[model samples]
Target: MKPNAAATAAALHYTIVPKDLAGHIFEVTLQIAAPAADGQVVSLPAWIPGSYLVRDFARHIVQIRASSGGKKLALKKLDKHSWQAAPCRAELTLTYQVYAWDLSVRAAHLDASHAFFNGSSVFLRAHGQEDQAHVLEILRPANVAGKSWRVATSLPELKAKRYGFGSYVAADYDELIDHPVECGDFLLATFEAHGVPHDFVINGKVPNLDIDRIVADLKPICEAQIALFEPRTKTAPMQRYVFMTMVVGDGYGGLEHRASTALICNRNDLPLTHQSEMSDGYRSFLGLCSHEYFHTWNVKRIKPAVFVDYDLRLENYTSLLWVFEGFTSYYDDLMLVRSGVIDEAAYFKLLAKTINTVTRGSGRFKQTVAESSFDAWTKYYRQDENSPNAIVSYYTKGSLVALALDLLLRTESAGKKSLDDVMRALWQKYGRDFYTRSTARQGLGEHEIAALIQGATGVDVARFLAKYVYGTADVPLAQLYAGFGMALDGAQASKASLGVKASRDAGDCKLAYVYEGRAAHLAGLSAQDVLIAINGLRVTAADVADGLHSAVGRYRIGETVELHAFRRDELLVVRAKLQADDMPALSFTVLEQAALLRPSWKKTTRR
Candidate 1:
């Protein structure tokens, strides 16, 4: 477990500067203390961890060259993302310019206002010396516009002060890229959760930003998650944490990191100083934060076995995303209620919405959650028009699976056990001290979950896993809810539907998706078909608001109508018999008398 003396001494040195803010370019220099005797290969990662897609980050390099002892060394492109430098005994220096225009969390982005980048998008890996200590020096931009810019990253400081640009250090290459850097004159707030300091940094402007309310609401959520993993100690895994968010006009996404998270949210989602009521947007933003915060323990550490050692050059596939993402989805909302941020009524509404989303898509009938998790790289990420008909989402359906498993665990164990126990067990065995321990890190295996569940909760879930996870059977939510002092109800739509999702596109009713075997699909309607009219009545873009609600809702079930639509340039007329909406409108109601006896259904006070 002792550190290698040579590797420790010969740290990989890197320097990055915002060379041209107007042109959105970053100049990066890598200094290898000792070059290999044979040709030393250097390459940028093809993808970032947490995000499953292979993004081929090297394509962003505008130009790259190598040098040793002030003389140019030969650099040859070996592959799409790798380059080989001629053997040199002197310290090898590789300089490159990265085009950082991507405005997402996964890649680098730069402009006059701000600069942000993931290390994966800017730093190239020195192949043979990846395990060596890595030091990063962030140089201030020469332009006057960046004079006030401040650096924000979770990377441990070497010569740099917190939030000030100078130098940072990482134990190895993996640790180097795990922390993303954000440089801007951003708004900042600080809060303490169970003795750990957490920073909330906002990059964009808001009219009357309410920093106190956000910190108050998020503090409990963070503390609850910490307690969930380490209930007895109530200790967080990180020394310090950061919530680095970029506020935009309209955006909502987050990618988790070990001690920090990169997030993007709508500016309107932030609370105003005068605003006292919780808006849906604000609740959603809080939920987003909770979701990513939970990942500090879940996927970020208790990872799938394959993710333990990531091969950034290609997709690292795993069939347990359901457990990682789906369970996180289930807990994201639940934590809101547990932290006293939202009430039971609001929690139930969110739960119902998730159920509706899963049931509305017919893809669940064809594909299981396991298959959905396995094919996430190809099917989930690269979805198209037929996605609703072909693939299921491990996120939505996996949450349902987690819900069902939790309910079943509580029921079978006579309320003595729950999914919380299993999660804590996973943390104890796989997550807790994952980074601090000197032994080889082990991730959760593909087929080890069922056994772990039984061992932790004393409940056999083989049949449950087989039916819902491996097989395409829907979770028996109604039956599960009945036992938990709740009633699940669905309202059947009375009006006839084309079973097509439509949107207003260019002053016309554009059919976005026609569900398979539905009235529209049976009438030969396809996606992207422009609906012209129905029964001699003109259909405009207004009629398609909320998915053809006005145009199609007027007709009753079993009614026949003449539909005219354009499949590209060809006009088609077809008489179709409308069918009742198959989409489930689900809701849950708490049975008062029965709920009194159920501890699982009862709400608890915030710690």
Candidate 2:
């Protein structure tokens, strides 16, 4: 396609009108100049970035019509996803209406109440013209007042009553399509810290939020992020950053970007009332805020080489999601501790919860962190009933791996080296210095990570990664903890065990493994028979432990108990002798409490 200076100007003049009402219908009219060539096609994307599935965005488009110079032009459906313009050289106006009832974050929706648009769902992706700049002039319904219309976008808002894009260029179409825009009567707030401006574009009503307190609480999070980049780059990339959010209506998630993030959260998630002080939700929300903000360095800039330039049409597989997302997940809470927003005890509680949840899942035995990261597109993103049985979460496993690695590095170097050093090294080498040059666009390679560890800690991490990360073997936590002069004190837990190594199977959860002399074995419970009820409570293996807790030693040793179960779909009853299973359990303790085992600014807890 040749550069058409005039066409570029015409593209900027495009406008959209919203006739939102009680009915689930909204129309879009695209004003385009028809080229001389026939069979030129306009198409919608099958999927958007951040979301790793092919959701045909064009399916929602109904009743498409094309006209030229006030005269109806013949249009044909060239394919299921595209429409062709007739042979003519005239001003072409294309119009279409979409079914907007599903009020999801990924698609478009409009009703008498409100409207939501995820860019790719409503805006036509003008092919061949991506090189040129375009502007969107929104014409709100006449009955709608300015107060009834608010706009949200990651793109800087132009003062000319329109949103403009100067050469819609990115590493790939994935980045381009992921940018979104929202319109409605929503609240907006602005705050600044560390000389960087921030915007909070809230869609819908405002909660009883205390603006000053919220900002004050966020200062540390923002400062920690600023500090992370300052030593490496000395400056923030953009003068202004935005957070386009949908406040509180049954959905919550965020998609990160270079200068902004699009988030969907519940209004209750935002602390506005005194009741918020009593709930843990506020802390979780702050953790979320810190997590995404930290991404400004970890992921948005220092990304995996595979993700540096995305392939929007398919999965971009990499064995580093644990490094990217898992590390981020670990830091989300750690940032709270480092930022003074959360205490050390609270941080450990979060870690303990993470361990309990991740370790309890049987998938850890089936998938390694490296494999989990690589298979995110197929297994992680598209979760199913068999997910727990066959897959470990990279986010969960990777964070644990990061924790182990951090402890290993710190102890090996006598507290002289830490994960922070590794992050700073990467930031300095790749994010700050290398990302600016054209030649540097090749992106960070695997060797870069290996080299950083050797230079920073003088430790050979290759074998550790190859074994624990790349293979489906249980992580050597005992060895890693020993390095930190600590030992897992679960010797008591394993002593008391039920006959069952409770686990889910074939989507139909049940206790699959039973050991002889265990309490469950003495209780007359056997393997391969469908576990119908435990202590008269009908539940899966996940619920049996909780049921046991409420028993209060009701089923003691030598007590005859009624065990109801199903054998191959046939319900049966049996009696068995109940006895306690003696097994040692796992817990955390310091082998030799070190005085230096504390955060940079925190008081020492060593005795």
Candidate 3:
């Protein structure tokens, strides 16, 4: 059926109200104009997109009931997330209450101060009517505490005023859940990028928040990404975009949506009115913004084949996340440099940090990037204390893979083609007309990426993919950097190390992770062991704060020392041989004369 015809058909209407602010409950009412002949089946999603974990969102539904024509209808539980209502001829309505206390971006959170939620966490999907339009009515809270709250979402307004609580319309169920809603008296700002308006909304108390500075910094980054995907037209896919952020004392994360992104960051990450210089926290915050913004073209649209129709009921596995997520990671920081937000030195520092992160884990040698992508649901998202020793991150290593591919493409094609060309090709073939041409919405195949790269850049990368992506071989980043007129070297630490990461736990030095095959592991020290002393010297939590390795730096390498620690209230002593610090510390420098051959490597063309 045509898109408009499907939309004009009887739509599924929903009304959501922030009821019981102190109790953190949201009452949702779903009305189906044309209920199924036998029965209507509805279900909540098992997980939100982007974050690859089965959250079982339906578990949060507190109470549910069904009714038709003022008569109560029998409802039967179908499964953990699905339910079926008895056959009804008249319009069917189901009301349920959701317990929304999750404070992260993926789920719902509500309190006396503010209310935020993703549709997947609140709205129930009418199984058969997913193609029809979905209308949402957000009612303002009745209590006096929420008198000044406003709504911020990318959902198209139907009868409601912009930023006012009322009704909104979505193309279908897929589009409905793609926009997260934030209701509060938020700090709002607007800017245009390539003639497209972008909204920035902040939902926490931030004294002296510099909204102007943020707008200025974000404009160029958005324009650069738009140009990257559509260089000739410089057009953006969405009519309007939003960056909905929630600020707190100390937090950092972001979840990408179709036209908007939900982010949480520390209050200190935001620039103050009097601050002039860029701080590390601010740079990191900008990088996070850039990363999610790039997703506007990458995974949000150019998805893996398995994601073409997301089975939110179960896990969706794919091995191509290295391209979808990893490539985006590589460009997130590069866009900063290309937009002139940061210079070469700053960009190199960020790049070096990523390289060191990937190199620090021995798990990289055991797991391929493709394996990491496939096991994301199991290992990456559900990480534990020994995660670093057991698994590799598709994000960090995938970015390195992207870097290697870009450098190889540049060298092989004489700089005529690079990863940029491949990305543009992907956008053109798989992403550009995705939303507009609904009939042709298809995702990239897992094994087809190698062919796509060859066709786009005229460079065969099958062997490269075999060695770096499918195999557990490092990307040889040092050689790749040298080819781009840059030198990559590791910096040695000045402190001796126990090769164990520690944190202060109630004034005790708690070992968080003992590196595999390192000094601590060889000495039989385990995670969760609280250190009491080292070589008869009392070790305090303050020593762990200084650096676990620094506390042991006083001893010489290979020197034997007595270590006293508490394992579950049991005191134990063991002799340990100190080793040199082996944490990866990478540095990059430009080879000026060689770099002159490739100016694009250092700087990108700005619009």
Candidate 4:
């Protein structure tokens, strides 16, 4: 049995103190029953759901005191997060404090301003009997008087007024763990689409960024998903879809929830008119938001069997991460185009970037998508220097695999069907009215979706999955792209007269990487050499390609330019003649067909 196999919780009470310690600290209390066995132990989870890997939540447990009936029981630490309780025959309570200093989404912190908790750090599970119903109550600072800041969570909010936010009821331990609660001073924004309520609980002041514009832009993506799925079944399970985010910092990402998601992001993610002029960070931020939101349907509900009933003690292996995470990745950007957020050229540009990434990664040759997903605990989650050489990313390869399968379906079906149909089919079979009944009691099964895809796609996908997913064989990229009207013109040694690919490495201008027999090599450039300046202009790795491109962008074909570099710890000038280069380019063109063909599964492209 797992360490906390029979862990359960009867009730949880949380209070947000905005000014507890000069406006820092959030107090949390857990009420649980003593396990049946006298020698048994209770503990907190080292990590939360969705995000695998132990965080040693005990490190943040500042004070922990256990008591039974009306008398205090002496608790002794057996190990991190687990404690041996003194002899007791009555109910017990555990109270602890979590430091809220960091303003990030994944952990708990407290400061002079607000509080954030990730549930894993503060909520305790009853050692046995997880099926028992649970409740959570939240309290705000009494002295700090102001209109109640918005309360948001995936769990249903009870109608109560005194403590800013009321209690949440969970059918059992599984439901309690699935829903994460976050409360702080924030701006609450609401929008409606398809008659479903969408709420945004945002932190910080009136966003200097355009809030309404961001909502308007995401409308189509949401509408398209609803339109496709609702056609299969009119009444879906979801009622309130909440999106929570912090608007202060530059680095950002998100975690998906059943009816809501929490995102940590920057201001630039807002869609601006001069989008091209926006920084690369902004573009990547939008991609993350799109990815997490898509998970509501694909991952949160339609899940793999391995993930259906999560084992909180250790890693739960699933070969279908490529299907779950990767397919979602493929759609994150495509939805942008389908929703008219971007144009075809922009869409291809994004696809081209993924192509470049997959082609360049060395791990693709070593690990298959299935292995990547299964070994995610040891390999994917804990990335190191050698990761580039030994391990493939399930997320990246999975996305490409999803793309290949979609194109194959399109080509084989003669433009009559699509991957979209596969998604709709899964929803119809699994996603019934979640609110009417209790999804709390009925956890999802992954095999159901897998079985549906096998019947729909007509490929013994299970066998293919067993091989490429379970085994470390390289995916047949060359074959997969052909049917999709795309191709991977295999990488050839560049003739740039330089052997090195220069890029900004760790905030400094340096030789990022080197390939043998290139012009930079012939010119005598070695790796790790700082490139202080190029062509008499002080340069970093970021400016190398663009700077090189700009020098040739203005001139007609056959233009020549002199390049200077800091080579061999010395400033050296090397002259590189420009050539109309097609060697490094990955190109896709539309083939002319006799008649207009719509995007579908069967129609073949002539171009």
Q: Best TM-score goes to which candidate?
A: 3
Q: Per-residue lDDT for 22-49 in model 3, tens only?
A: 9999999999988998999999999999
Prediction RMSDs, each to the true structure: 2.2, 6.1, 2.1, 6.4
* Cα lDDT tens digits for candidate 4, 1-607: 1113232133433333443645455666766654455744667777666665666776766677877787777888888777777766776666666665656666665543445566666666666656566666766555443344545676755444422576666656666656655566766667766778777666654335555656666666676667656664433346767777776647587878777777887665654553434345555666776788788877777777666666665567776677778888988887776666665556666777776766555666788777777787788878754465577888877887777666656556665556777777666555443323455523335345446765666644565555556565555656765655554564453332233445665655566654433444445556666665445566544457553444334444443445565655576776544334323445445343211122344344433
Q: TM-scores of the models, in the given order?
A: 0.96, 0.78, 0.97, 0.78
Ten residues in sequence with the least summed lDDT for candidate 1: 592-601
Q: What overall lDDT goes with each candidate model?
A: 0.90, 0.63, 0.89, 0.61
lDDT of 4: 0.61
**What is the descending lDDT order?**
1, 3, 2, 4
Give per-candidate clash totals: 0, 20, 0, 30
lDDT of 2 by residue, 562-607 (tens): 6676667887776666545432244566555422234442236533
- Which regions in candidate 3 have their CA more than 4 angstroms from the true location? 1-9, 593-607
Better lDDT candidate (2, 3):
3
Better of 3 and 4 by lDDT: 3
